[model samples]
Target: MGTREIGLPQRVPGTGLPARVTIWEVGPRDGLQNEKAIVPVAVKLEFLDRLAEAGLTTLEATSFVSPKWVPQLADAEELLAGLNKREGVRYPVLVPNERGLKRALEAGCPDIAIFGSATETFAQRNLNSGLEKQFEMFEPVLAGANGLNVRAYLSMCFGDPWEGPVPAEQVVRVGKRLLELGCTQLSLGDTIGVATVGQVEGLLAAFADAGVPADKLAVHFHDTYGQALANTVAALRCGVSTVDSSAGGLGGCPYAESATGNLATEDLLWTLEGLGIEHGVDLDALVKTSAWMAEQLGRPSPSRVVRALAG
Candidate 1:
């Protein structure tokens, strides 16, 4: 897709929001990775095309992890091969280790992401490793991602399914380590959607105090408790310009049964439009695309904005 800019609204004095925000679309990778039914590769490619047509420039394409762990994305290589790579649009694959990194590199993936957990319990459960060991596992992957855009996703940043509240200090510590280890960006994830506005503010403040600029961080929220939009506003107010959301709310935490879907891209766009922030995404196109994908999944979209607009 050729680069295009949507006219930005004039910045209102005293408003802390940025002139433009980048919505990192994670539907193909994070959204469908946990689904019980495996999606066909052709459908996956069509989904990606629709997203690009809707002007989503940054998309998480697929994950190069062991299929045994995530069978839903078993065709990651095939999906990458079949993708219609667009100009000025990024398709970042997820690499869990050096092996995954090698696979992604072999497939000619130019961008990749690694995931870590803030709490020890989740680190052990999700990664099958302790907190420190998980970082050690990522070291080689980050090192091998030479000349590639490597993003770090820190999961369970606010609360954990096994453990309760995660400490702000620990989130800062691990997040700083990921940046130090060569991640170009850090996406703080509320994996279980338990983050409150106060927790979001506290974590951003802690990260700021630790000298990690907001420009290098992105926020990923789930709407399990209906706080995704509220938490997103908090992050934006804290100067975070990048946000991760899935189309049609097409995601849930496989590890946490209580967790619902991710913050819908349509819903996020609705809020950004209302706030007069420029994101360059066509809300109607996005909703229509998501509604079509939901049909493929044999369910209605869980996103309120999509439902309202599609109605």
Candidate 2:
């Protein structure tokens, strides 16, 4: 093989992967929320614009949670108000509860996501509610959505630090409940990111067996164990077309300190490109954007692709 060819994987076509994938970019929201210092609303707006210009269609904008809980996202309203939302680009916000839902409605958000926990300990810790009670809490938020698009995030799907190895059965049970609560899509999260490719395939199989189609699911993987990309490919092979990624691998679960380093958007894009899948993201543009964000955060990006390409 030529030197350039040796450096790149073959552009294989139609290896049973989805023809198109929707990347749910979570930089401005998930990435920035974990920052020690609160990012300015103007900076967030600029970040969103950069992401949109880089051809990412969906960007998680901000969360409407209690300011005291996640102080970094306290400027959600201001961020949305100042946002120059692009046509055909979606900027969904996270709504943690009924009060959050009300604020999201007032902000004129077209799409929103709710966070759910698969394990009881995480549920109690994150939402301050029991496993079953968390569903009760989500009922009103889903009810008040008024036909707007709603996505649900089920955390600790793979493993939890407090509770070891989550069962696929448990994950499916919580996922179906979330879907039943009017969530259009359910994102399975590896909160502590301990999933291997085998575990990923097995969980997808369990979900399929439970009558939940892959189209209704998205996968949010952290790279704590260096398995995020592997898990993603397994999910993609199982027909999951939507994925959740953070730009520059910037954030993890604040409540779960062990959940570090979300799957980077640039890395996913690189893999998609090599596989000849259509994602429509401008890798160079996105790399530059992440570089800018890293500079703002006063650190280098954790994304391998960003480090390699933008250096």
Candidate 3:
């Protein structure tokens, strides 16, 4: 959404990297949330199956938001109920409030994600609440999740639109509070895709200083400014391994103008492969998936690797 200039400095050749990294594919959930054309439920199920076969261990399959807000995923409960659950693979659904959590529970989803904004303006606009009120809303959701033994993921930690340049301390405070409120992992989101490596480094450093280890953190990046991969690398360099990405780079913040999409799954895989970091995903299979989805939408594939593979 925001224009940014990133002059990538080449990394040294042959930098041996980690053996594997977990990719929590949010394509079905975050990716299609903003689609103008309605995606059939059966098509979504097949896509999930394809992603599973591609070896993604964690897949964010759907969201239980109100149909009035996200009509595309209106069949969230039916979608999850019909998914062929695989052993040892996680399917987490994005749950906005207690009602959404209830719907997800009814659909047999074992994991739920709760979202809150780092800025008051976005919070009021997105969730219709201020920062304190948003946390208050999470209190009930957290209590319910604890009672049901379900896992929670927190979103919107990195940057926000309403308030420009959210302070690192505020991010730390929000993250720590979510951890205290029973979120299993805190995902620092570059919501408007405005974060730079320097800002990312400063935030991770502040979190480390606050004693929040990187192990409990995941980075959610958007490629609106074509810097998501760079920001992700900065997080990995800070020892944050888990990253959230969407296939075909679908979805943009409705409130954030000019936001392109979340970082594509293919793009992340390319970065991992170039770094020699192991990820269980089959790159070719992922490219196929992205290309298929892009065609279904009649849109150009946002993944550079997908385009290259197609060529």
- Residues 1-311, candidate 1: write the lDDT tens digits: 11222333344433788889999999999899867898999999999999999999999999998988889888998898899999989999999989999999999988899999988888888799988889889988888888899999999999987789999999999999999999999999998889999999999999999999999999999988899999999999999999999999999876566767799998898888878888998877788888889889988888887877675
TM-score for each of the candidates: 0.94, 0.95, 0.91
Give a tens-digit lDDT track for model 2, residues 96-138.
9889999999999989999999999999988999888999899
lDDT of each: 0.90, 0.89, 0.80
Order the candidates by TM-score, highest first: 2, 1, 3
The list of candidate 3 runs beyond 4 A from truth reads 1-19, 147-158
Candidate 3 matches the true fold with a TM-score of 0.91
Best by TM-score: 2
RMSD of each: 3.9, 3.5, 5.1
Query: Could you tell me which 10 consecutive residues in candidate 1 have the lowest summed lDDT?
Result: 1-10
lDDT of 1: 0.90
List ranges where model 2 is wrong by over 4 Å.
1-10, 254-260
In angstroms, give how far residue 82 of model 2 lies from its true place: 0.4
Better of 1 and 3 by lDDT: 1
